[model samples]
Target: MMKFFSPDMKCSALVILMINSFCVFSQIPHKFLYVVGCFENGTTEVQYEYDAEEMLYMDFDRDEVVYTVPTFLVDDPSKLFENLHIYLDAKKAKRSCKAIVVLCKEEEEDPTEESDPPESIIYPSEEVELGVENSLICFVNHFYPPEIKVTWTRNGLPVSEGASLSRYYPNNDQTFHQLSTLTFTPREGDIYSCTVEHMALDRPQTRIWEPDFSHDSSVGPDVYCGVGLAVGLLGVAAGTFLIVKGHHGR
Candidate 1:
């Protein structure tokens, strides 16, 4: 079991992130089952994994356990009986996670440990086309403590209309990663930026993006002109050949 407290928090009742694992060797292929939970901002997320693949997760929005692999029982006979209790266990885990967060209160601010600032990048989901709707993705990864903030700006102005943030996902290195997305139509001369704020950094990290259709959009016209010039030269050559042949015959 591994436990991670909310980074960047000094309050008495802070966020709790926990991951628990179980191994089964009854079959030829060994299997690993794990549960991960994060309690924060009056919300809880609990996920179940089998052999490093997600099997189920608690949906806080719908207040139900959603199965990532729908045919869980059909896929694994060993899990047929365990499947019945998995949902109940997830619910229990969620309750216990919340209780721990409430009970584990920090009387004073704990000293900040060495933190890892997130590496961030911003890019469009698809090739940018002027006047076409697209999404801008800001990916942040390899940050410790799992508490970070991401914000977006367009041409130096703050934007929030079509922006969304994803829940923190654990990486193999025990760090975390997250994504923020913004939807908008690409236009000429439009610049976008994604900024990340974390405790590890003295200053926020920012990544900028702008539509560069100069190369992609210009290929069509350039090809057309080149082809047209080649065809015109070929026509002139053919006409000269016919005229020379007529003069020679006369």
Candidate 2:
């Protein structure tokens, strides 16, 4: 059964519904709602979702409720919490979680079903320019289980410094996504790659990224214009020489 902290924040309470409660096959679509949080470094994030879609979340830093889906509305989102005393309880929950108290447990997936593999891509944060400090972002999406390892490499050598991984984020389809970033100064002919390992895949997935410096794109038009001018001058000279030869023969 789904468990949550009691309203008083002193004990754990079981919610009415269990994860399997919605597992039955039915003609009608089932709507599932969940509220989860992460407490780290004295910070808290309480996210609420319905049908795997983000509805709203409480921003503890801002002490405000932020709406994610525009279609989901309420007269006053804050009013729902004004009298509930949830802010204090959420804080208490965070403390309890840091203390190793289990406020909630993750539901395991069915063993018979196959795991979904994730797809990944590597890209720069902005337009790539050699000799400039920049960051490379490796985005992995549409994976189940929310557990994965990401590693970075430069020129086939393992890279560790200046690399960071973000927390997994849920997608509308219930899958998860994550990002890893590496900071470095771009240099010509430098090759970079991000490799991902997940239980769903038979082997690790690797994506490569490199700076492009074969030629300057900005000089392309000028090069073509110069070539055309040189050809035109040669044609003009050939035509004048033929005219003079014809006149001498006359």
State each candidate's clash count: 0, 0
Predict model 1's lDDT versus the native. Answer: 0.61
The C-alpha lDDT values of all candidates are 0.61, 0.58
* Model 1 CA lDDT for position 18: 35
- Model 1 lDDT-worst window of ten: 239-248
Off by over 4 Å in 2: 1-34, 37-46, 49-83, 87-114, 215-250
- The alpha-carbon RMSD values of the candidates against the true structure, listed in the order shown, are 21.5, 23.4
Compared to the true structure, candidate 2 yields what TM-score? 0.53
Residue-level lDDT tens digits of model 1 in 1-250: 2233443333322433333444465544533444444343445555555455555666767766666565645575335446477556666766775666555443324533435688987767666678999888787877766679999999999999999997666665545677788999998898999999998889999999888777676655654454454334333222100000011111
Best-matching candidate per TM-score: 1
Best by lDDT: 1
* Span of 10 residues, lowest total lDDT, candidate 2: 239-248
Q: Candidate 2 — which pairs collide?
A: none
